[model samples]
Each structure stands twice: as structure tokens, then as C-alpha cells.
Target: MVELDSRVETRDGVALVELVVRNPTDTARRFRVGNLLDGPLWPPRSRGVPEAGWDDGGFEGVVPAEERRALGYASPLSGGARSDSLPEPPAEIVWTERAGETEAGNDASFAAEATPEGVVRSLGDHRPPADAVPTPRSGDTVSTPESGRSEPDPRRSP
Candidate 1:
């Protein structure tokens, strides 16, 4: 089965409609949502061109099994006008079809199973090995190549 939730908001003389379509069944479904408002429907634009199916005052696509898809459109108000009344629900499910069915109760099997055998290490970690770290004895002076000078290692008391 399919379910739909719709909302509309007006901004700058344009009504923006958003719809969330949900497919609860184990089968994928294709659906068409038609514009229910009085104004013309304007699907979202790509590179200044309206999306496909904008002329038909509606949009259509597939919703995967057990998934929800969000769709949106815009309708420009006449003469940059504003209305005090909230627009009626801007979209309606005009039709729906079962695109395909999946194996029963197989939804959770696609996830890969993993077991952590040891501490994970990344190639970016350039730290030296534990035993390779230098530990200076108390009162020892360590020489640094950068300054060509010897300084007491701060880790141990002088």
C-alpha cells in the first residue's frame, strides 16, 4: 500500500508544495501525483528548465518498497499577489501501480555482516611503534637536528 502526506506554503508570491510518498508494502510502486490547486503546477527546475512532466500539472515516479520519497513543486501566484486563505492540499495521488515485488521478509538480509577481530588501524596514522619511542633518563640532554642544540627532555626531571 501507499501513503501520502502533503503540505503547502507561500513565499514571495509563489506557493511551494511538498509531498512525502511512502510505500509500506514489500513491493515497489509507481505513483502519479496530480496538482489539486487552481494554479498551474511548476515542477522544480534544473538549470532554469522545468522538470519533466510539468506541463501535465503533475509528477510521477517510483517509490521503493518500505521507503518514503519527497517531491516538491512551485506555483506562482497571479500578479505577485498574496492570499489570506491557505491553499487546499496541493497534490493528490492520481494513480499507483505495483512495479515489482520482493522476497517475503528478506528486507533485512541485504545488510553486510561484519565482525571486529582486532583494533582497526588506518594508513594515515603515522605514529611510531610503542617500543620505538625514545624515553630519556632523568637529567639527560637530547639534541635536536633542527636547531643543532641540545636541550633537556621535558618528560623527565632535570
Candidate 2:
């Protein structure tokens, strides 16, 4: 499971949020993290692969939170300029697995902050913090963590 924390702070003239993600699994998995409303949001890719579920217009990089925002990217939960029509920011962590896909079990909100190192420390993973968000997976559809969802057969194709 992925643990994410979202909180708000200010940058430039906009209110932004920071999302911290932690990979509890022992094996390093390719993942994508992003704001649902802003099309594709930021650390665009990890371990090389596209880290599923990310939309277009997403940038790729691994840096601290402060540097991400300084580059003018919206916070993961900012929702850009269409907040009224979009659902609350559905920031998530996603990865590809035989089960088709999997998403972090929670839908958390976030705001911007300056503590990039703190965010990285909070993530508890070795990956550098950056502005890129992740993609979503089919695992997101299952509401329970212990639901025992079956993994897709690797031999099969979508």
C-alpha cells in the first residue's frame, strides 16, 4: 500500500499543496503520482517506465517540493482553474501489476509547502521529490485493501 499525505501552503500567487508518498512494499515499483484534475501532474516517471495512468502534458523529473513549485507547476491538488467542475483532488499512487493495475487505497487532498526535504523524508523512499504526479490503476476500483483482488495473469493482454 502507498501512504500519501496532502497539505496546503502558498507559492507565487496561488495556494498549493504538497503530496508525500511512501512505498511500503519491499520491492521498488514503478509508479505515477498526479492531480486528477490538472490533466497529468508531476515526478513524471520513476525507474524509467511511464508509471501508468498519467495523462498528457505531464513533466518528468525528481527534485524537492520547493523546486517543483518554483517551476510554475500547480500543486497536486490545485485542480488548476476548473476547481468548481472537478471533483476534489484525487491524488494517488499507481503501479502496473498482473492484476491489471493498482492504485493507492486512499484519495487524499494536498496543498503546497516549502519543506521539500521534509516531504521526501515523509515519503520514506529513496526517490528524490519532484513535481510530477503518478498514474491510476484498476486496483483503485476496489474499495478495500484486504479485498483479496486477484492479480491478472501475466500471460494475458489487456
- 21-124 per-residue lDDT for model 2 (tens digits): 55455433334555544533443333442332334543222322222211223444444444344444445444422111232232121222224433443344
The residue-level lDDT of candidate 2 at 153 comes to 33
* lDDT value for model 2: 0.39
TM-scores, in order shown?
Answer: 0.56, 0.31
User: What's the lDDT for all of these models?
Assistant: 0.68, 0.39
Taking all chains together, the TM-score of candidate 2 against the true structure is 0.31
Candidate 2 residue 77 Cα shift, in angstroms, is 10
Q: How accurate locally is residue 93 in candidate 1, as Cα lDDT from 0 to 100?
A: 88
lDDT for 80 (candidate 2): 46
Colliding pairs, model 1? none
User: Residue by residue across 119-151, what tens digits does model 1's lDDT show?
Assistant: 111112344555676667666887887988999
Question: Positional deviation of 22 in candidate 2, in angstroms?
Answer: 0.6
- Displacement of the residue 113 alpha carbon in candidate 1, Å: 37
